[model samples]
Target: MSIIMQYIFNGIFDIYSIQSNYYFFLTNLQLTIIVTCTLWALCMGYG
Candidate 1:
């Protein structure tokens, strides 16, 4: 579980680091929002 979280965070940071344009930034922002919602739902379900 810790490893999975680490991997997800790393992926998020990597995506942020690679963003170099407005379009890419907007897409990444959308992706981040989606991932955040999914993680929140999983936590609420498990908690």
Candidate 2:
């Protein structure tokens, strides 16, 4: 039960924090695309 709660908490954390290191050069539109793509992938992966 604790493990499951931790997993849920981690998933919530992932949704809040994007993988930020690689896309520093991206413009706002490009960053929005990357973030939306990541978020969509995360939703699909979690669901």
Report the poorest 10 consecutive residues by lDDT, candidate 1.
Answer: 16-25
Clashing pairs in 1: none
Q: How well is each residue in 1-47 modelled by candidate 1, as lDDT tens digits?
A: 99999999999988877765667879999999999999999999999
lDDT by residue for model 2 (1-47), tens: 99999999999888656655334545666989999999999999999
Number of colliding residue pairs in model 2 = 0
**For each candidate, what TM-score against the reference?**
0.56, 0.44
Best-performing candidate as measured by lDDT:
1
Candidate 1 is scored at a TM of 0.56
Question: Highest TM-score: which candidate?
Answer: 1
